[model samples]
Target: MKTDNSALARRLGLYFVMLWFSIGGIGHFVATGTFASIVPPYLSDPYALVYVSGAFELLGVIGLMILRTRRIAGIGLFLLTIAVTPANVQMWLHPELYPIMPQWVYLLRLFAQVGLLACIWWSTRPAPKAEGIRNGPQFP
Candidate 1:
């Protein structure tokens, strides 16, 4: 038996994204206060922002699972990750404010977010169609 490693990797990546967002989306509702605390003060209505982002996260997960919707979902999720950079930045900028972990951990999260974006972009991309000469029906 032979294995197609690229296909395997892509499948794993897609599942990772789905699971990550699914849990995070649920967390947004279940632990609204904890998620809301991460929101930067500059933003208005922390709760609303949290809810909206959470809803988007869940939507993205659904879109990711369906082949027809994967592309749009990847795009939306990529932008969402970018959109939340500021909150991550704030966490890094002032460790005193958010004591959830050490300063290094917050900084590591910023880096991890970049990796996450890359994963979403690469994994959700449509697989290339196989190429071969037609067995029949030849034409210009």
Candidate 2:
């Protein structure tokens, strides 16, 4: 019996995102107060927004785990990444706000965000069609 490598890759990719976002969701839950503190000052109520965003992340991760909803989940995650860019920019702009973590840690987080965005992009990308000599009727 031969195994389809693409299928395996897809499963691995799905599992990777599932685990990655799950951990992020947990971190948000565990450090909601800290994360709220890190929210940009422009937000009217950073604490409420942080928790709401955390809930969305947790739900998105759970949705991504199911095959039927994988595409939607990927889309949601992609939007979430884009939506959070302000925070990334704010962190880079004001490192002192994240004093609990080293400067390098915040930079690493930004890079990791890029990686996650790439992964989500790869996962939701349409599979390429197989190309082979046509087995249909041909001119003699």
Candidate 3:
């Protein structure tokens, strides 16, 4: 019998996403000074705020990794991504404030957020049933 690879795929996908988000959250802590520069000028205490954001990211990633809470975690990740978009926009608009990064890098980072948002949405989507597939050789 063929192994049910769908479940395996889902698990692996979740692992990658969990690892990605969790590390990104940790990066906030490790690179607090650098990360704070990207916060919009209007915001106060950027450093402290980022630490709180990192905590949420860590929690969301952990929740997604565990089966029982995957759905809720996925939802949280989706919302978090949306929530953080303002900082991304700030980075893109004011490259001068983030002098450490090149303009092109900032632009690409903005684009990457779109992909990350899509990936989080896709990773959390409910898995389709195995029977939903119609197996057959294609003929043309």
Candidate 4:
């Protein structure tokens, strides 16, 4: 009996993504100022961007829940993650500006971003249809 480990993994990943984004999305509204503070100096309307990104994060969570939309959601999330990199970079580069966060946190945030992307991609991937024949031709 072959184990459907991929399904299990996908489920777990989905849960993680859902919870992670749900909280982050809600944070945009909960502490809008805090989230906006990290925006790069060059960006205009930091508050709007923060709120928009938060909305997308919540949308991604919803997309991840439905099987039909999972792949596209993963792609959106991947791009969204990339889009937010600049803010993370800004934070890392301007540690003096964000004294509340420890130096290690900047590094960890960058690393965690990569992991989040991987999880979103892996979890949203559709399982191969020919499972029984995945190993080889089925022998009757």
Q: For this target, which candidate reaches the highest lDDT against the unseen true structure? A: 1
The list of candidate 3 runs beyond 4 A from truth reads 1-10, 131-140
Model 1: how large is the Cα RMSD against the reference? 6.6
Per-residue C-alpha lDDT of model 1 across residues 27-139, encoded as one tens digit per residue: 99999998888899999999999899999999999988777788789899999989888889989999998886999999999999999999988778766443121221111
Candidate 2 pairs with clashing backbones: none
Better candidate number, 1 or 2, judged by lDDT: 1
Report lDDT (CA) for all predictions: 0.82, 0.71, 0.75, 0.81
Q: Each candidate's TM vs. the true structure?
A: 0.89, 0.78, 0.81, 0.87
Candidate 1 error regions (>4 Å): 1-3, 130-140
**Local accuracy of candidate 2 as per-residue lDDT tens digits, 2-120:** 33566446556767877877887787888988777777888878877777788888899877656566678788988988888788878877888777767777888889889889888
**Tens digit of per-residue lDDT, candidate 3, span 91-140:** 77888877888888888988888877777766676665561322211112
With a 3 Å backbone cut-off (N, CA, C), the pairs that clash in candidate 3 are none
Shift of residue 103 alpha carbon in model 4, Å: 1.4
- Expressed as tens digits, the lDDT of each residue in 35-113 for candidate 4 is 8999998999999999999999999988877666777887898899899999998998888999998878997999999
User: What pairs collide in candidate 4?
Assistant: none
lDDT score, candidate 2, position 68: 62
Quote the lDDT for 75 in model 2: 89
lDDT of 2 at 29: 82
lDDT of 4: 0.81
* Residue 26 shift from truth in candidate 3, angstroms: 1.2
Ranking by TM-score: 1, 4, 3, 2
